[model samples]
Each structure stands twice: as structure tokens, then as C-alpha cells.
Target chain A: MDYQRKYEKSENKNIKKISIIKYIICVIIIPTVIFIGTKLFDGKKYAFLTAVVVLLSCVPFIISFEKGKNSTEKMVILAVMIALSVFGRYCFSMIPHFKPITAITVITGIYMGGEMGFLCGALAAVLSNFIFGQGPWTPFQMLAWGMTGLIAGLLSRYLKKYMVALAAYGAVSGIIYSMIMDIWSAMWQDGVFNIKRYVACIISGIPTTATYIVSNIIFLLILARPVGRKLERVKLKADIIEKD
Target chain B: MNDKMKIFNTYHPLGLFIYFASAIVITMFMINPVMLTIAIISGIAFVLTLTDIRTFLKNLAYEIPFFILIALTNPLFSHNGVTPLFFLNGNAVTLEAVLYGLDMGIMILGVIYWCKCYSIIVDSEKFIYLFGKAIPKLSLVLSMALKFVPVFKRQYRKISDAQKCFGYYATDSYFDKIRNALRVFSCLITWSLESSIDTSVAMKAKGYGLKGRTHFHNFRFHIRDLFLIAVTLFMDIVVFTGIGTDIIDFRFYPKITQINLNAESIAVYGAFIILMFMPAFLEIKEKIKWKYYVERI
Candidate 1:
């Protein structure tokens, strides 16, 4: 048992080192490359920007999965949650622009950890688009949802305890999703950043944005406690990570 | 195995992916009226050839109004052109803006159609096959997520049916319905989460995530795939050059530019048309060949 404890301690140390390296890569190296590439490659900046965003988005999952003690179990849980989120979107297809995907993603993050949340959010976007149809807007959707999950996971301690905070986060996520998408629209419209056009795009998207916010609030308020409780239970049962 | 040899299905997944990606990138970037028209027509033809008549017509019915909405909305926001068609809220609805809006609408529809075709062609299997080697864990998670969608849906249906049998109908009061729905959802969460433990255990037992693991792959890069890739690359290069050199450029803002129908522009248009219509043309050729051979037999 003492030897087992020593082995586990070494494994934890390794995970910590790997995570630190991943953070540096995700936060520093990727953005620097994108900035430099944009400056250096005048003709292909858009492609370069997209490639960077896509690559950065995967870092969380890669780091988290590698760091976790029971990586397979953690992956399975994340995969299941993402599937649930995607299915939730389909379930709400009768209502226009009303989906529980964001809420589920946030909940996944709050319970599973931020990295898992991001994975759930990003994968949910890509997978749901398989049904809804893919477009230039897909990457934006992925970013928006992935960030939502990541933030929720980061703030899970405060959020898991307070229903109001969870609801607020959901509303904010909805706005973020709409705003980012509007940026995409404006860019697509003019092929350059025009402030007037972007503002117009934002103004035009208000109604849908409002719906998204309300639906997010409703879904989060409804799903957070029950879902969070169940997920926590699963994490414990599966021994996904060592106890703090 | 015999199904793999069909023209539309024959190319290596990577080859097909490159073709679709290049096509989409070109279609989205180049907003030339001629190019947009070719894209829309070819997109429609491809959709029709690939899907049944009923599905094709259904898609068109959905697409046409969406097209109109996008085209009509653009003129409202953008008042760039010189020729004023009408005044809306004291803003001049310029002819250029309307025409540009129409072009944008067509481009949007064309991209959507192409994306639909892409989804049909690149099933989850193909997607996993392409990305699995580089990111095995991610591909595994993605495949599991996809598989879980239907599984969870089925479980939800079963749970709801069971609840209904116990007189928990959603037709009750709004609050009651919401509560009951939440109850059903929570139950699904518990059930699925519990089952995933079993799944992970089974996977671990099967030696998943271990070193020296080998996987079965059905995809093979044939000579035809190489030819397809070469042709697609050639077309993309020609189109990109034309765009880069401003030979096939069109401007809508400030004023609409006159389209040059010169030899270079025509070549650009021809290359785009060929690229866009390649799938539809191949599918038709295969259909004709099958018909002729059957008649001879």
C-alpha cells in the first residue's frame, strides 16, 4: 500500500508537469504563432487564424485526458455528456433557436472539470452541426460553446453552490454565442472589419439573442442541480480523479 | 466491399475531404456573380443527383425562402451602390446593395447545399478514419459521443413512456410539466452515467489506450483517388490564381464593378464550373454506364 501511494504521487507529479506545459502551449505559443502568421502571411491570414483557433480548442481535452488518473473513464463520461447535449439540442428543435446544449455543456464543466467541459462544448457544436448542416459559422459556434464550458468548469466551485450564478453564466454564454456569431456575419458580409456593419449585425441579432439567453437561463436553472449531483456521483463511483 | 467501388464513394476519404474543403473555401471566399451562379447551380444539381427527388424538392423549398430572406435583408443594412431602387426609412436601397444581397443569398444557399452533401458523404466513420490516427483519444470520444446520441434518445423515450404510463403527462400544468420533464431528464442522466462505467471497464479490458494497439482500417488510397486529388488541386490553383491576380474580381461596395468577360475571366469561370460540377458529372456518368450495361445484359 505504501508503494502504491508512492506510485500515485509520482503519477500526480507527472500530470502537474504535463498540465503546466499544455497551459504554456495553449496560452502563449499558439497565440504568438497566430499573431506572427497573420503579420507574415498577408494573403492567407483567415486560414491561418482558423487553423490556430481549431488547434487551441483541442488543447484542453488533450491535457485533461492525459492528466486524469482514469483517462478512459473520464473520456467516456465526457463523451456521454456531449452526446446528451447534442441530443438535447435535437429534443428542442421544435422551438426555434432554443437549445439546452449550452446548459448541458456548462453543467458538464461544472461537474467534470473545465477541460472536460470545453471538450463537451466543442464536440457538441461540431456533432450537432452534422445534423443542422456545417458552415463558416461552425468554428465560431465551437469557440463560443467551448469557452462557455471552459469558464463554467473554472468557476465550478462558486457556480455549483449557487443556482443564481449558474443561471447568470448561462445567460452570459448565450450572449457570447450570439455576439461571436454576429462578428462572423459582419466579417462575411464585408470581408473586412467594418464597425458600422458589425453594430448593425449585433442589433439585428437581438431577438434571437434574447431567446437564447432566456432558454439558457431556464435550462441551467432546471438542469444544474440534478445533473450536477448525478455527475458528481458518477465521478466518485468511477474514481475518475484522486480526491483533493 | 462492392459498395466502395462506386464513383461517388470510391475516392479515399482524405481525397473526398480535400475536394469538399477546397470547394467550400473557394465558394465562400470568391463572391463573383458568375462563380456564385455556377456554385448554386452545381450545388443544386449535386443535391438532386445524390438525394431522392422528394428530398431534393424539400431542401429547395426550405432553401428558397432562406435565400430570399438573406438577399432581401442585405439590401436593408447595406446602402453601398450608386443606383437607388427605393428608399427605406430614408436610406437609399441601392441597386448594387440588392444585387450584392442576391449574390450573398446564392452563395449562402450554395454553401449550405455543399455542406449537406459533405455531411452525407463524410459519415462519422469517415471522419474518425481520417482523424483517428493523429488523435486517437479524441476520435474515440467523438465516436462514443455519436453512438451515445441514439442510445440516450432511446433511453429518454423509454423513460418518458414509463412516466406516461404512471400518469405523468406533459399536458399537465406548465410548472408540473417542466418539473416532470426535469425529473425525466435527471433519471436519464443517472442511468447513462452509471452505464458508462461499465463501458469504460469493458473498453479497458479490451486493451484500449495500451501501447502497441492495432486498429482495422478499410480505407485505401487508390490511383483514382490520386487522380481526383490532382484534378481538385489543379482547379483550386487556377481559381486561387485568378482571384489573387484580380482577374476574376467583383466589387459591390462604393459601386458595382463591371465583370470582364475576357479570356482569363472565362477560364476562371470554366475551371470553377468544372470543379463545382465534378461530383454531379461523375454520378451521372456512373448512372448512365450502369443503365447501358444492364440493357446489354
Candidate 2:
């Protein structure tokens, strides 16, 4: 019994190490590969490629790590999440008052972990651009939105209860997301990055940023508690099914 | 039927290489707008010869109005040129400005149409196969997204119809229509979300994105692809020669030169026109084959 326990602990430690390595790969290596690929390949086609790749990479993580009891039920939940992540942006963008991706990302982060949250943000950008049609700038949108999801997930851990902290992080996430996207635009469109280009991009993004801040706060206020409770209920229900 | 269309479709690396070389040549040589216009026209003509008028006309019908709107608006907003056409709200709209707008509008349409043609003729599977290993995430996203559209549209239409049958009227009233659209959108979004998740799960189970990656692709590159590359390079050389000797030009600004219409320029324009209609050409070929099969039956 003692020897078995020791082996289990070592196996667990190895698994944890692998997971950490994956986290590093996802947050750093993937982006670097995308960046270098962008520089070498034709810009427009490459942008489309990046968006697709990011979405594809998420498949394994989503499939293997899910805690759902039934495969069909698990699939149905994921589908809803993906739909909300992707088309939800378009729906909100049309409203003229709501920022779709930011709201979705924050909500998703609060519900799912940072990893799933990040995928939601990035996939939303890629899917939304289909309606806008693919272009030279789609990858920037993916990067920006993906980061928003990542930040929201990270911030959720620290700002677990305080509404003010939640709201502040949401607002900051919007600004940072836009900034990251515009950095690429400034480089590609203007062929240089400077204060002038930054100003131009930021000025255009005001309405979007405003909507994001408002939507995030609204979503946090209205949906967070209810969704959290529902999530708890879902876990309980799953537990019952598993015991059966 | 000749090499140019084949070059554009199968040998994209070669096409890209040619693009870089010509871009360098044009920039370095300071190619005149007139000469560039000639070259662009020739390229269009070549595209046209491969395809037909129907496809070009279709794109023109779709894109012209939007292009015109952009072109007209730009000159009104930007009054920086020397040659004034009229005064609008204390702004002098110049002939140069108007011409520039029109020129830009035409260029934008041309590029859009060219891209459309490229999408139509180039086998998307081939593109995915070529770059799948280099960028798996992108390839997967693009393939899935492209695949999603047709499925999405079909499902959306069916759901909308079902809703209508269930007394959900999608009316012309702005607010009501928007509401209706949102309902449909949300439902579709839900469906797509589920599909993507399932797909991801399946991919993962199949050992996708594994540390030791094994890719699956069935892309076939044939003798035609090689020929296409060679011919495209040859045509690119011809284009460069035209630009280098001041026969073709590309410029943007106050200097508007009259286009001297020559036979070679006309031929080049013809080539470009052929290139633009590759889709129509393929469709026609398909139809012809079907007819032949039917006759045999």
C-alpha cells in the first residue's frame, strides 16, 4: 500500500508538469509560431490560416478534460458555448450598444477555466469574421479577442467576489485586447507602429471599447450568479448520473 | 487552355515568387501608371480569355455600386489635388481627386474579382494539403469554417422556415426583423457551437495536435502544375520587360497620363480578362462533359 501510494503521487506530479508545459506552449509558443508564419507567408491567406489553427488546437483539450457524465450532454453544452462565443459577437455587434466578444469571454472565463475562456474569445473573433468575410486583418481580431479571454480567466481567480474588481478587469481587458489587435494593424497597414497610428486605431475603437465595458459589467451583474448556481446544479446532476 | 490559368491555380509558391520579383521590379523601376495600367489590363485580358464575360459581369454587377460610392465619397472628403472640378461645402473637389477615386475604386474591384476567381479555381483541399503541416491550426480553422458556411446557411433557412410555420413572421419592420434575426442567429450559434465542440473532441481522440504529429492529406500535384509554373514565370518576365522598358507603368498622384492603346497592351489585357473568368471556364467544361456523357448514354 505504501509503495502504490508513492507511485501514484509521482504519476500525479508528472501529469501536473505536462499540463504546465502545455499551458506554456499554448500561451507562448503558439503565438510565436503564428507571428513568424505571418511574416513569411502571404498576409491575407496566413491570417485565415492562423484563425483556423487556433480553433483546431483547442479540440483535444476540450474533448479529453470535460467533466460531463454523458457524451451527448457534454457535446450539447460545448456546442452552445461555441455558438455563444462565435455568433454571439455578431449579434451584440449589431445591437449598436453591446460588445459581444468581451461579454462572452468574461462570462465564459467565469464559468469555464482560463483555457476554455481563451478559446471562446479567439474562436468568436474567427467565426464572426466569416460574416464580415475573411480579410487581411482577421488574425489580429483573433489575437485580440483570444487575449481578452485569457485575461478574463486569469483575473477571475484573483477577483473572485468583488464586483468592482470584476468590472475593472473587464474594462482593462477590452482596452488591452484592442491595443494588441491594433498593434498588428499599425505594423501591417501603416507599415510602422507609432503614436500617430496608435491614436488612429484607438480613436476608431472608442465605440467598441465603450460597448465592451458596458456589456461586461451588465453580463457580470445579471448572469454571473445565476450561471454559477446553474453550474453547481449541473455538477450535482452529473454526480447523480455517475453514481447510477 | 494554355499555361497561365494552370499556373495561377496549382503552383501558388511559384506565383508568390513571381509576385515578389515583379513587386520589386515595379517599385525599383518606378513603373509609370500608364504602363502599369497596360500590364493590369493585359493580366485581366488573359484571365478573361480563360473564362468568360458572364463571371466578370456578375462581379461587376455586385461590386460596381459599392466601388462607385467609395470613389465618389473619397474625392468629396479629400480636396488636396491641384485641378479643381467643383466646390462643395468650402472644399474644392478636383478632377485629379475624382480620377484618383475612380482609379482606386476600379483597382479595388479588380482585386476583389481576382481573389474571387482565385477562390473559385484553386482547389481549397490542395491549399489545405500544401500548408496543413506548416500551420495545422490555420488549415483546420479554414477548412472547418468554409465547410460550416454551407451547412450553416442550410440549417438557418430550415429553422427560419420552421419558425415561420410556427407563426413567427419575419417582417420588414426594422425592430421586429432585427429581433427575428437575433432569434435565428442565437439558435444557429448554438448549433454551430455544439458542432465545433464535437469536432474538437473527435480530433483530440484521433491524436490530433499530438507531440509526434502524423498528418493526413491526399493532394496530388501533376505534370500540369510544373508546366503552369514555368509559363507563369515566363508571363511574369514578359510583364517585367514591359514595365522595365517603359511600356507599362503604375503610379498614384497628380500625374495623370493618357493611355496609348497598343496591340500588345490589348493582348495582355485580353489575358487578364481570361484569368478573371476561370470559374466560368471550369463550369462550362463541366457542363460540356455532362452533355457528352448524356449523348453517349
Chain A only TM-scores, each candidate in turn: 0.83, 0.66
Candidate 2 yields a Cα-based lDDT of 0.55
Best-matching candidate per lDDT: 1
Regions of candidate 1 where Cα sits further than 4 Å from its true position: A1-70, A242-244, B1-6, B85-90, B170-179
Model 1, span B1-297: residue lDDT tens? 243445777679999999999988788776688898899889888877777789788767877887887788787777777899889899999999888888878877888888888887877788889988767787888999999999988998899889988987657576676567667877888899999999999999999977798988788988989989999999999999998889998888778899879999999899999899999999899989989999999
Q: Provide per-model DockQ scores.
A: 0.57, 0.10
**Distance from true location, Cα of B76 in model 2, Å:** 4.0
Model 1, span A38-136: residue lDDT tens? 664453225425634665766656665655565678889888988888888766665788888999999988888787778788888888887777667
Please give the lDDT score for candidate 1: 0.82
CA lDDT, every model vs. true structure: 0.82, 0.55
